[model samples]
Target: MSTPDRLIEATRELLWERGYVGTSPKAIQQHAGAGQGSMYHHFAGKPDLALAAIRRTAEEMRETAGRVLDAPGSAYERISGYLLRERDVLRGCPVGRLTMDPEVVASDALRAPVAETITWLRERLATIVREGLDRGEFTPGIAPDDIAASIVATVQGGYVLARAAGSADAFDAGVRGLLTLLAPPAGTARHTDAVVSHHPAS
Candidate 1:
């Protein structure tokens, strides 16, 4: 890859593995196998490079989620696909991790992508919930936006639980729990038992 690409990729990995405070310019240069001159030549500074990396990570997250959310399936199935989709549970979420970084959260430029991606995800999920409600797949009374926020909170919180426990079981349990709550009532259009049974805990 080109020098710029190398730098961005290295920054992305470093950001995921280490927070903004830990990912230094020297560390980035060493990880990318690029010298100080090359890094400065390709980009203005660390913030510029980090922004690029963060944007890339955010875009990738959106694309991955969009695929599952847009897929041909019932609202529950599509949401199930998103929650159950393969993830490095122990490593936690790349974008979600950024929110914990003091430096990243403090900077408007650095935090924009992360915030936007999260907002986009919540909005998309809300749309799906709305669809299900409209089609009578989900019971009435629950608000789409509220349910959407809960879903995102569950996944993000699940990551923290899993990382803290040094096991993916915590994450799995959270997903199962949420799914159980989201499953329609027993005799509803989308049977609760079938929906929950379809995507067994894994």
Candidate 2:
């Protein structure tokens, strides 16, 4: 890879492993196998490089989530698929992890991508919930934003629980619990036609 690409990749990997507070310019340089001068030649500084890497990961995750959550099926099916799909359960969400780091959360350069990524994901998932409501696939009274936040929280919290407990079972339980909560009642129409409503839409 080119030096800049190498620098970005190294930054992402380091961020995932060490977090923003723990990673240093010298560490990035060493990880990228590039000299300090070369890294500085590309990025203005650690903040600049971190922003680039965070944006890259954000774009990748958005594309990936669109694919998984929009896959052919009822909304529950697609969402459950996304939740249950293969994962490094113990590793946690790289972007979500940054939110827990005080320094990363304080820096606009570092925090913007993390917040935007999560907001984008929540809106995307909410769209699926809205679609399901349209198709009469999910029960009413459930707020799309609330449900979307819950799903994202499950994944984020699942990782924490898994890492803390040193097992994927907690993650599995969290997802399964979500599936149970979202599943529509048997023989029930999920929504009414002509007056379908979830916060009056949008």
RMSD of each: 2.1, 7.4
TM-score of each: 0.93, 0.89
TM-score for model 2?
A: 0.89
1-202 per-residue lDDT for model 1 (tens digits): 9999999999999999988989999999999999999999989999999999999999999999999999998888888888887888889999999999999999999999999999999999999999988877787889999999999999999999999999888988898888878886666645334544544333
RMSD of 1: 2.1
List the lowest-lDDT window of 10 residues for candidate 2.
Answer: 193-202
lDDT of 2 at 172: 77
Candidate that would win on lDDT: 1
lDDT (Cα) of model 2: 0.82
Pairs clashing within candidate 1: none
Tens digit per residue, CA lDDT, model 2, 42-99:
9899989999999998888787788888788778777776787677777778788889
Clashes of 1: 0
Q: State in Å the error of residue 118, model 2.
A: 0.8
* Model 2 ranges with Cα > 4 A deviation: 188-202
User: Using TM-score as the measure, which candidate wins?
Assistant: 1
